[model samples]
Target: MSAINKVLFIAPRFHTNQIGIVKALLNEGVEVEFHVLIKGPTEDYAVLTPIKIEEGKFSRFLSKFLKTQKVNKYYAFPSFFEYFNTIKNFNADLIIIRDPGRFFSIVSTIIAKLLGIKICFYTQETLEIEAKNTFRYFFQKFYKTIFHAEWITPIGGTDTRIKKFLPFVVESRFDYLNETSAIEGYSSEKAVAVIGKFTARKRLIWALKLAQEFDCKIKIIGENTTKEHATVYQELLEYVEEHNLGDNVEFMCNLSHSRTLKELSCSNFFLLTARNEPASISVLESLSVGIPVICPLECGTSSYLTPEKTGYTYRQDDYDDLKNKFRRLLVHVSEDKKIRVECLNSSAENFSEQAYINKFNYIFKRE
Candidate 1:
């Protein structure tokens, strides 16, 4: 074991949260670098150097074959040569592979081991619910073992959730580095917040229905990841215009984290329409800001929702169920003052930026 002075992060895409984490690491006096292996150029950040990965046809086919098509297509995938070359060039003390299930990660782990560099992988794959004998299930199990890293960081932040997907893993291997949020107090307004990327997976249409039916304001905040999603946003605007709901519907695109949290703090409740969300950082932020949430039971974060206490959970992708739940909640339930304080306390104790930094300072130490 030696001192960990430098670390390298390999990610598919570099978002705001990732940037924050890197800045925190830098503030701790660790030299941080990133290989953002996505297809396009990365936005310049002062804290870290982000290098874009160039993927060839063979790498793309292999990524698809490994059933990591979603991550590879949206973020970026590295070829074996790319991974080896990047690791060789950096000479970082530790390597953090953001997604363990990707084909390139398996190669990265092998290369890191050969170089005697400490490496760990962060995983968000929920494969326990997958049908047995399916290709995806097999691939997931296969990759889990092939990762062969020194540690595993499961994003679920629970033993049960991690076990459900990766049952064979040991407790010691679970490095629970959860995301963090800042709670800037709360204000109850007649508004519902819908936050996250403006992608098809978010199921924003369901949230829009609530705004259409209810009298309160609906705030949709997020950036479009693609042209198709931008068109979806446009169609949503058209729907609002046609229904003359412009006064109730407000679209705030690509807000900074602090600004988004400020908007979330004023809202009455946050809405989650994504049926199969692994876990939402926005939902955590909502809870941190003392705002309750209404999420589908299928969402990983739904486990945090306590009915009539913190928030509510409807059936997955059931608009009728969500509508009924919303109606009942709007009429019967308001964010209780005690519940708001409790929510803030729970989130701050568990998911604050300081807590995250403390965990990293301890765990990032080389063993």
Candidate 2:
């Protein structure tokens, strides 16, 4: 008998989460295929065997218009014809979509229903954000239409956002664990790391100001996503230069996932000042490396942070609160190494990679 060639994943981007899931499925002897529907080129990752759907200029224009009108235009377009052809060619038994908020998932679902294929929708964002308007309402209805699968998995702390809409399925998030045994305490010189695209929502400028106030060395890591954000990046650079914070603030652009892990391994703290974050994988990654994360309360991932334990959470947009937290951490660093160890232990216990993999396997096996 042939092995169960079980799952296919659809997404616009490939990141650590996708990489982890594919690795897990392969280890279980399950055949997996990735179908990406976007107008861009693809990156080469070792495990993600991606099937890229190239879009013409007209399709790209329409996709941009839909996104601007509302987030749900991703569902109403004709992008799924290509996706359906890809799925049919692959003969996949299970279809796993990364974010149902996109139009491709809506189209994929319709094709899956007609073909008698099971559909599993995975989202990392809150249902509230997904359904924030009328367009999203229609998108949710579209999701209900193709949600004929045995499970629905959401990775993060925002499960409550979707609990009311889809009550009869399994849910889970990415798990993190400290894999290394090198326990180095924070040095007399403080260090902070912020990992994410340099968008306005990431609040990189605020982090720079806070770094200057606390006399801490802050490393900003990520690429600029759009030309619109170029001004913000420039303004941040100007601020760092004007204040003579060249020594304290360092901007690192577009590091690979492995290189990012190495940076986090050496850092004393993780900094996330996102004005709005559905769920941050960066926080989980930080915790996995036993590095404490400091984030604003508005972030969905802040729900997992325990003050003075796993990390610190401050009120959103309050620069003073951030400064106070940094000040407290500075004091702790100077007075006690034991406090840092306690923080590391807490993060390791809660966010282990094994825990995440086991949960994913459970969801995949659900009837």
Best by TM-score: 2
lDDT of 2 at 336: 59
Q: After superposition, how far is residue 313 of candidate 1 from its true place, in Å?
A: 2.0
User: Which residue pairs does candidate 1 place in steric collision?
Assistant: none
Segments of candidate 2 deviating more than 4 angstroms:
1-5, 39-44, 56-82, 127-146, 150-182, 224-226, 333-349, 364-367
lDDT of 1 by residue, 1-367 (tens): 3687888877776644465567666776778888765533224365566877677667666556555446545423566666687788889888887666555565667788888887766655433444333775566456545544444333444433122221111111001111212122233345788986667788887777788777677889877667976888888888888988888888998666667767776777788888688766566667766777888777765655567676778888678888888876565345345655566665655555555565665555433
Score every model by TM-score: 0.75, 0.79
Question: How many clashes does the backbone of model 1 have?
Answer: 0
Give the alpha-carbon lDDT of every model. 0.64, 0.64
**Candidate 1: regions farther than 4 A off:** 16-20, 39-49, 56-71, 74-85, 130-147, 150-155, 160-189, 304-307, 328-335, 357-367
